[model samples]
Target: MDVMEWTGQVYADTPIVSAETYVEAPPARVWELVSDIHLMPELSSELREVAWLDGLTSPGTGHRFAGRSAHDALGSWETISTIVDCEAPRRFTWAVGDPGHPSSVWSFLLQAQGEGTVLEQWAQMGPGPSGLSLAIEAMPDKEQKIVFVRLREFETGMKANLAAIKGLAERRA
Candidate 1:
């Protein structure tokens, strides 16, 4: 895996990190995995749990979910996320902590590639407050380093997520 480049960005920069893998399965099969919010914790390290909110059972634009995440340095926290975009078998996206001004935005994109699929996981950080913002508040001078480290963590986590999804999708295929 190539390391994602970071240029010491701060919160306002809204930096993005993405990782992708080729899955030996069709987009439909891969979509079943990515669109299921309940399955995410199984593929993620920092995300501990997720559940659909307001009696919702599936993803759709305007639907909401709660996600609990834990990081060693950042501790544990829960955030309500709203689905900003959902296109079956192609894309699924959500905004954490308010759709209007989210702390972060996350997405999964899938494209058919020959007999298989190319799946990408993407994330963008900060136009709002988050655990990272708290850390930055404590040490303003370390904002750039904090953002860089967090972006690296996001990149690593996305790569791992793609790997796990690839394994599962291929096995099912």
Candidate 2:
């Protein structure tokens, strides 16, 4: 697991999807586990591994990371992500390249919630290409339903990931 704060100008104007959860740990401890990009696999069962593609220092802006995630005995997806923002023990953001359906930006924010920590995750998808939009428009109602169904599926996947993180942080206390 190689994690670095992302600092770049290429994607300075991307949107983010933010979701939050409470963990039974202080902000500093939670930050240790979440900030270490390489240790993410150890923190969650769903994360198989995370690697740094570009050699860089830890938790610094503009560091690149890639990781594989699985859906407990069902399937998995591989993403090559680059850190867009890195603010220790607080917030971090990443962008996944050419994710097939839509290019996406992901972010995480951590805050102290009384004796615990509140973790928030956000994702932004789209900036779709012309051809992709055309194809989506050409699809019939049934096909359109399938598309939205898959979008929900992705959202569920994100929820599971967040749950895993929460579980890990809680157990540490």
Candidate 3:
């Protein structure tokens, strides 16, 4: 058997979701899209908007941003995200809520393969406070189901974002 077995299920035991897509463009082209946090609102299902914070024009390690999101289940909430990793044209990572005690950690990884770039979006849900935390507090026994559902929502959203990125990058190429 494989060392990692993913059966398309996410128990609260596994609070992560990731998706990848290939863009027939150089890493730089794809990077242009992924690193532009402001563009996320157009592609994401839950994120309503994002704006740079602390007078920063672009994200870099230690920079922060505010995001407004709305989900049918979780309703609406705003978060302050702090950039944790920034390697242009390769990777960008950030933590939501608090960098040291985040509700979630998300990353975009770009790898050059042949003439195209493989872009992967990954997210790990909290060990901190979030809507899920409230839900878990209310129904501790259904934690697994709640996490699984949220992860599935994340997977769907990431896939759509990747598709949008691919379309934009290829058209620009």
**Candidate that scores best on lDDT:** 1
Query: In candidate 3, what residue range of length 10 has the lowest lDDT sum?
Result: 1-10
Angstrom error at residue 49, model 2:
4.2
| lDDT by residue for model 2 (4-106), tens | 1232212123333335678888888787766778766764455688888777647766677777878642377777777777888888877676534335666
Model 1 sits at a Cα RMSD from the real structure of: 0.9
In candidate 2, stretches whose alpha carbon ends up further than 4 angstroms from where it belongs are 1-18, 39-49, 68-79, 98-102, 128-147
Candidate 2 lDDT at 144 equals 41
Relative to the true structure, candidate 3 reaches a TM of: 0.92
Best by TM-score: 1
lDDT tens digits, residue span 114-142, model 3: 99999999999876688888887889877
Instruction: State the lDDT of candidate 1 residue by residue for 1-173, as single tens digits.
Output: 58977698889999998889999999999999999988899888889999999999988999999999998999999999999999999999999998999999999999999999999999999798999989999999999999999999999999988998899899998
TM-scores of all models?
Answer: 0.97, 0.65, 0.92
lDDT of each: 0.93, 0.63, 0.86
List of clashing residue pairs for candidate 3: none
The count of backbone overlaps in candidate 3 is 0
